[model samples]
Target: MTRCRLCGSQATASVVDLGATPPCESFLAAGQLDRPEPTYPLHLRVCTDCWLAQIPPLITPEETFTEYAYFSSFSTSWVEHARAFVADAVERAGLGPEAFVVEVASNDGYLLKHVVDRGIRCLGVEPSVNVGAAARDAGVPTLTAFLSPETGSAVRAEHGPADLVVANNVYAHIPDVVGFTRGLRSLVADDGWVSIEVQHLLTLIEENQYDTIYHEHFQYYTVASAIRALASGGLTLVDVELLPTHGGSVRLWARPDGVAGEPSRRVADVLAREKAAGLQELSGYTEFSARVAKVRRDLLRFLVEAAERGETVVGYGAPGKGNTLLNHCGIRPDLLPYTVDRNPYKHGRYTPGTRIPILPPERIAADRPDYVLVLPWNLRAELAEQLSYVHDWGGRLVFPIPELSIVEGTS
Candidate 1:
């Protein structure tokens, strides 16, 4: 952590130091809960040279993603988002029956399934054994391995260079930013495109989305830093799109250095926005730590007062971001006795650091708690509707990030 992971510079600045917490997705089994749980320093620093905000690479992707607990298909909105992205990408790239598409870190073929439906040749590079099996079961061709330079070249040799390589929500997950970008460059044809969707540091600061910072997400990006990261891999930035996923994300389109045409005007427009926000300098980050502290205080106050009133409060999702929120706020089972998730794999397990029990979604209805805390507030629209039944018993939903607020029902 002394040196920047993206740039080899010793001059770095502290952004936020979310105290030690276990790996966000490391849900513990009942037997293991009795044993000691390991925690690491969950601190994020920015490279003064490159402006790339990152955390220490304390955990490897293999450790967390091999038997991954998350399944992209579980979220209805996410699945539809993937479907729409596939359709738009195909049309924009002039993809045909003969065109080959590949998606790195493809979870359970959520995005590639749409490509399969269109009869386009597609492959999924997923590291998780269990989720990769699910992708295969769903008839999406998959290779079980992490994305590295060697892995990318091996795929190219076996199936030929892809026309389009899609990577979503995984660009920031790798510690070796330069190596991962090179691997991405190795996956596509000389003239093919690589589209990546990663959380934008701009909105993360503007909206107080510090909960998204965790060990798995090693680095966060701005358009300026992203352009530099792409150049390190021998790729040229072509276009950019502002997206609503993961609080706020940027969809970057790149191609081989020479083949990539002049940069799009949107790229300059977004860069202008980032510059206006002061993200390229130290001024943008000075107040972020203060805002993050306020978020922790406001949520803790609500949970404590509710407990004092003898009112019951439970959590709604066991996402990685939720784990960060819970651990950073020092919340324990005494305040949030249990949380429910749609994924059955975590049904009987416990959250990594907080030790809060994870139950099935139906448990909320069965117990009818006074309040249901929605941890994955990024999906406010979707979960608000899914949990509309809480209104039946006068149970309200609470969102902790951006500000603690209560909602009667669907937004």
Candidate 2:
């Protein structure tokens, strides 16, 4: 963190220091419980010179993505979201059966399956071996590799240049931003479209969604910073859309600078919103550290009082963001007991630093805990309906972020 990764600037300011925590996705097995887990500094800093918010590159992308546990198809809503995006992209980009679409970091073909169904030619560049095999099993063509400039050129040479290159939720995972953008340009046609979806820093700050900060995400982006980041590789921003997924996100439409005209009104509007909110300067970040501290205090207070009252409180989902919230707040198995997830890969494993046991979703209904702390607060609507059966036992749900709130289940 001595220098900004995006721009070579020595002038930087501390936004929030989350202390040290293990890589959020490093789940532990029963046999490894006695071994000491490695932890890294989790402090977040912002570059005043470029306004780019980033954490130190403590861990490499290969260490985290080689054998990933997260599968996008597990969530019904997420799969549907991908399906809708594909349908819209086809019409918007003038894509047809003759056109080719390439998706970088395409997880388990959750999106390309829709493309396949439409009779459009598509290939997925996925990093995880296990998930890439699953995508192939589902009849989706996938290449198990990470996107780099060399890899992109080979793909173009073999399969031809892509008419539409879609990169969703992976703009922040890459530490080498400029190199990755060059890779994107190499894979796309001279006048092709490049669409990327990432969580918006403006919403992350305004809504107090601090749990999203983790080692996997190297940098956070506002519309202003994103415009500059994309420009580093000859990609120009032409349009932008605000999305509600992942708390709040931005869908950026870019193209090779050759055909990129003036940006749309939406891009200007979002940038103006960022400026008005003081994210361009230091004023907006001044009070963020205090707000983050308050969140940790409130969550701990509720859990401690519940324990004293002889009440059983368990967690609902085992998301990566949940690990950040759990470790930062010093929550262990004694407070949460265990958390459940639909992803079977995490079953019988333990969370990285806090060592909370992860069990199957069926465990919740069998044990009947009094209150279930919903860890994946971003999926509030989808999970509430799925967990509605809790109401039969007079159980309620708790959300820790955007302020702690307890509510009854949906009937």
Candidate 3:
């Protein structure tokens, strides 16, 4: 019985299996091209008691992030998002040269760099070695280790309490969620704020974003579920903001117990909207598997049709979500000639399981393929603009999940 990691709820309610898939970030080395790719069962289940959507236990964080490949600084849109987030938070929180800020899972210090530029003391707790080194090189001091109650306590003892603790897109990745959140109680100052950004479970189900499922992403969160989990760890939600990033995410501002942190009206409003959308009910889980299956079917049909017509199809953005979508749809080199990535680490590699080569974006211009499939559909607009040069060849871009559509004015 795989119990709920946060609430210890042992009721294994509804399981939606997406069958064997490879580690989303294990984009293969170039030499291993011909070798058979390994995959593991990709199944998701909902905790009936807590209403948390989670994947069954399989891989460990060490297996996922030790030598992580995905670098956040590579994406222009993501960097811009990070910069804007830092600017707003610093201003909103009155964090200036005197404040101390900490960011958990601060991959390559993408957001912290902006905070550091303001001369405020900032620290990063990152588990991945390679990415941590990159951040250090960028002059962002980072602790190359996982965040836990012990680490948080030690840090608090040494550096004193933080004014702002940010965990962007990381609340969903933690396994020892309760312990981690408990740790927050030690590090966050009495008047400090801890902001967590997670992909909303309500949005995931309503929008059919099953592609977000991957081993690294252990939990999908909702405002109600998050408040419940945080309350258990002695934190209270103060405010909530819905963000447009990652197909729709929520930023929950919290503080330690008895700190006068009341859950905002927006929090209640969002939870009400979530309940109205049926996230608290079992019916929401019923159609997700079928919707995921439909995604696989529709995508395969489109890829095979494109292949049959002798129209070459390629993929853009070798993101973790793209890996899930590709592996689930069984896309191979034959279907997607290759995928392009801006990250140099993934440039010469092959996507795990799918074995589709990940080359530089130059491949898109050189090949002049008929269609370029935008895998990270959330960044479709940015990528489309970047590849507008494809218009010269009369080629068009294709976005599969959410909906299948081709950009106009090109082949």
Candidate 4:
């Protein structure tokens, strides 16, 4: 009887069970393949009281993130996203030289670099030592520690309250949603604002993005549930924007409770949309398990047929979501052969469970396989453009999620 992390209620109902899986980020070395790998049950539950979809934090943060392999700077599109965000945020907030900014889970200082370039004071809070070292090397001041109430207070005492606190794609990573939101409230000045980006639960269900579920991500928040979680820490939502990144995400702008100014119409509109989508009720979640199971069967059938036809297949991008898809479908090196990634950290490693070798993107052109499975289906357009050369040799791209489809000629 696990209690809901947000509302502390026992009315949590099962949403979907993904069986036992290893941490999605746990890539393996060749030498370690023979050793036993640990796995945990990957089950998601929806809180009837608050409607927060979440999984229990069976794995500790230290075990999953202390020495992370994923670095934000490795992806060109992601870096561009960060730059655009910094440019817009600075201008929108009327920021100047004296303004202070802090970014939580600031991996490799990808976004903070843009702020520092503008001659503003900024600090990065990152938990991974490897990524933090890279951030320091890039001339970004960073604190290699997890953010909590105590750490937030210490940061405030040393550097004063931040004018802007940016938490992008990190709201779902925290195990203690209440304490984490409180820490966020403590770091911002009374008049300052906090901006949070999280993948919307409505999009996840509608788009059939079950691959995003893993041990590292604890919660999937709807606009209504997100408002409740933040309100517990005395924060109030003032604005919200929908972003196309990571399937579909929502960027929320919040201020301390009792602050002047009414919430924008966008906030009310999004909440209404969520309610209409049935995110506020349990019936909406009951059918998801069947959808997920259908995806697994459909994908496996495609891969097996491709193999029977004597067509060579490989994977593109070694993202965490790809790991979940591969492991859930019981794909192995024989089916996928190997995958390619732009990140050097994962280049020489193998994916967990499936143990498919990961190589550099250049190998795709050299091998010229018949079919390339675009594992990170959310970035299909970017990947299609980058790998357009494959079409020269009659190679087509395949997307497994949201139904299997063959994409031709970069479209």
Candidate 5:
């Protein structure tokens, strides 16, 4: 039996089983299609002891992230979010030229570039060699290494403790939750703060965002579970913010234990909300498998019906979450002929198991398909605005998750 990564308990209850799926980010080149691709069980379990929803690490970090393809800079909304975060954090923390900043999983220096432009000394710790090299080229000094207790200590020793440590959307990628939190804590000065952004488990269940589950994300954390995990590493939750990014995420601000920072009222508010949502009990997760199964059936039915009518359907965005959704629903190039992405790296590549051809966003305007399946449903508004020209050709946008819906108008 696989033990819980957070509480080390064998009382892990199976929540949802997505069968088998290949690594979501493993986009394939045309030449590599003849080779065999590996897949692993995509099962999620919740620890009865700690209520931490997680899956076993079937693949190593090196296999999933070492030479990553997903770069944060590709998303315009995400870059704007990063800029806003840098501005607010710098002012709130009273950061200046003397104050040092560090960002973990700093993909392509998207956020740190804002900090650097402010004349602050900042460094990035990114494990992806390609993204790290890109960050360096973008004028952000970065170390291409995975953050661990040892690496964190070394970074602290080499560049002094950080006044603000930012870890955006990276807390879930870690298998060792406690160790990762400890490493984050180690990088902070006594008066420093650590901010982590993660997609909230409550939102995942309520919104039927099962697509977010994949091999790379080991754990799905509730506010209560996050607090326990951080406390295990001697960190205290000082504040919490509900962010609309990534289908509803929570940005948590923490400080070392015994610090004087008062806990924000928002922290208690979120904890209460999670408890009321049944996140603290196993029953809360029991009905998720049924919900996920319903979503699969609903999405497949829509696509199959569309195919029967001889309507052409394409996809938008090549996000990792979209890969899980497509593979789970057994969608192929037939159902979704090809997907468009802003990232040039993914252009001309095929999705991992589904093998859907990825093209540049410009292809959408050229083909003008009857329907465009917005794969990254989280960015529906932004994509709708960007692809408004589709309406000119009587093309409608479709969202497959949270119940498949056809949207006609652009926001």
Candidate 6:
């Protein structure tokens, strides 16, 4: 029985079983041809006691993040999102020159650059060597190590307590939730705010985004679950906000006990909404598995039918979520010849299990396939609009999840 990682609760309720899958970003290298890639059992379970929705253990941070391939600076939307988040934090926190800002899992200093530009003392704690090197190249001071209680205490001794600690999209990645949260508790000053952004579990179920399930992402968080985990370390949530990035996400601002300030109405309102949606009950997740299975079946049928008609189909976006969807549905080069990505580093590589070659976005215009499968369906609207010229040849853009549908026209 897979026990909850946070609390030693053995009563784990199975949420959604995505089946065996490789690490989402484990792209095949030329030297790895002979080495058989390992695939782990990928399934999510909800802790009945803590309501923590997480995938069973697989890979560690050292194994997954070191020499990482995914770079945050590659995404245009994410860059802009990071910029906006920095602006919001500065104004809301009343940040000034005296304030020391720290960001955990700060990949390539995507958000920290903005904070540094304003002459704010900031440091980024990142694990990935390649990304940390990039952060240094960009003139952002970064510590290349995983954040833990000991490390946090050490950093605090050197730089003093941070006024604002921003951990964006990292609350879900840590294996030891308790230790990581304790580290945040230690590093932050009494009056300082610790803000974390994570993809909301409610949005994942509502959008039927089973593709978000992967090894790197250990936990799926809701507002209630987040508060419960934070409260374990004596932190209280003071504010919360919903964001559209990565389908849907929640940004939470927390502080230690007796912090002065009224709890934001949005925080209470979101928690109530989560309860109303039956997140506290096991039945909510039970229905999701059936819905996801249906999606897998329908996507396979559509691809098989299209192949029978001798139609050419290619994929767009070599994102981690896209890899999960393709690998779970058991898609191959037969259905998707090759996917294209804007990231230059990923352009010449191939996806893990399926080994579908990842090419540049320009390949779509050159090839002009009959149908283009938008695997990163969340960004389908933006991608479809950009590639609307495929309509000149009567080609359609197909989105698989939430049912496969083709939209005509090119921007």
**lDDT scores of the candidates, listed in order:** 0.94, 0.94, 0.85, 0.91, 0.92, 0.88
lDDT by residue (293-387, candidate 4, tens digit) is: 99999888888998999999999999999998998899998889999999999988999988999999999999999999999898877888888
> Which tens-of-lDDT digit does each residue in 75-160 have in candidate 6?
77788889998998999888999999999999998999999999999999999999999999999999998999998999999999
CA displacement after TM-score superposition, residue 104 of candidate 1 (Å): 0.4
Q: What TM-score number comes out for model 5?
A: 0.98
lDDT of 4: 0.91
Q: Sorted by lDDT, highest first, which candidate order results?
A: 1, 2, 5, 4, 6, 3
lDDT for residue 50 in candidate 2, whole number 0-100: 92
What candidate 2 gets wrong by more than 4 Å, as runs, is none
lDDT (Cα, tens digit) per residue for candidate 2, span 63-102: 9999998899999999999999998999889997799999
lDDT of 3 at 218: 84
Which segments of model 6 are wrong by more than 4 Å?
260-262
Candidate 6 lDDT score at position 322: 89
Estimate the lDDT of model 5. Answer: 0.92
Answer with 3 or 6, whichever has the higher lDDT: 6
What lDDT does candidate 2 reach at residue 72?
92
Which candidate model has the greater TM-score, 1 or 5?
1
